[model samples]
Target: MPKPEHPTDPDVEISASATARELRFHARPEVTVHAEAEPGGECAWGSDRTNLPDQVEPNVTYRDIRIDFRVAAALTDPTQDPSSP
Candidate 1:
C-alpha cells in the first residue's frame, strides 16, 4: 500500500482517539472517506448592560469545523465526482 499523507498539523500531537465500534470486514476490506470546507471567523459584538449605562461590547471567536464521513468496506472511485453527461 501507499503511505498516508499528513492530514492535520504535525505539531498537534494525536495521542488519543475513540475506538471504532462500527466496522465489519470480510475477504476484501475497504473504506470510503468524504470531507468539506467549514467557515471560520472572529469579531466583536455589542451588548446591552445596565451597570454603566453604556453600550457593552465583547470579543467573539469562531472555530473551523471539519466533518469526516467514512464507510467501511467500500470501493474508491477514480474520479471523486462523476463527470456530467
Candidate 2:
C-alpha cells in the first residue's frame, strides 16, 4: 500500500474530551465522521462534545454528536450525480 498522506479521509480527527478537578465524565462516545467543505476542498471531519447527562455539578456542558463512516467517494463517476442515491 502507498504511504498515507498527512491528511487523509477523516482527516481532522477529533473526539470528546475534558479535564478538571471535579470532572465527572464518561468514556468518549463513538465518533461521527462527516463530509464538509474546507478552505481548499471537501474532506471528512468529526467532532464530539463532552458527554454529560445532567448539570449534576458545577462547570459542566451537555451536547450532541453525529456519526457515520461510509466508504465516501469510493466510486466517483464523472457522469453520475454525487448526491443522487
Candidate 3:
C-alpha cells in the first residue's frame, strides 16, 4: 500500500502592533540615544552609540553588538541627563 499525497498551498498572515522594540539607525559618525516619557516630559538617556562601522555592509544582515539597559544614576535622572548619550 502507498500513502496518499496532499497538495500544498501558501498561507498568508498579517500582524499589527508588534511587541518588539524598533532599532533606530544613524549614518553619522556618532549618535546619541534618548527617550521621553511623554510630550514635554522629562527626557532620559537611552544608550551610547559607539564603535560604529566606517561603512555599512551591503546585502548582509546585522545585529547589535551590545545593548545596555543598565541605567546609571545620571542616565536615570532626567534632570541630570546630558543632551547626548
lDDT of 1 by residue, 1-85 (tens): 1112432222222221223323322333243334322222111112222222222223322123222222112132445554544
TM-scores for all candidates: the values are 0.17, 0.21, 0.21
Instruction: Compose the digit string of candidate 3's lDDT tens values, residues 12-74.
Output: 111122122333344333545443333223332223223324354444334543333322121
What's model 3's lDDT at 22? 32
Could you tell me the lDDT of residue 5 within candidate 1? 41
- Whole-model lDDT per candidate: 0.26, 0.37, 0.31
Which sections of candidate 2 miss by over 4 Å?
1-8, 23-36, 39-51, 54-85
Worst lDDT window (10 residues) for model 1?
37-46
- Candidate 1 vs candidate 3: which has greater TM-score? 3
Off by over 4 Å in 3: 1-34, 49-55, 60-64, 69-85
- In the predicted model 2, the residue pairs found to clash are 32-67
Question: Which 10 successive residues of model 2 have the least lDDT summed?
Answer: 66-75
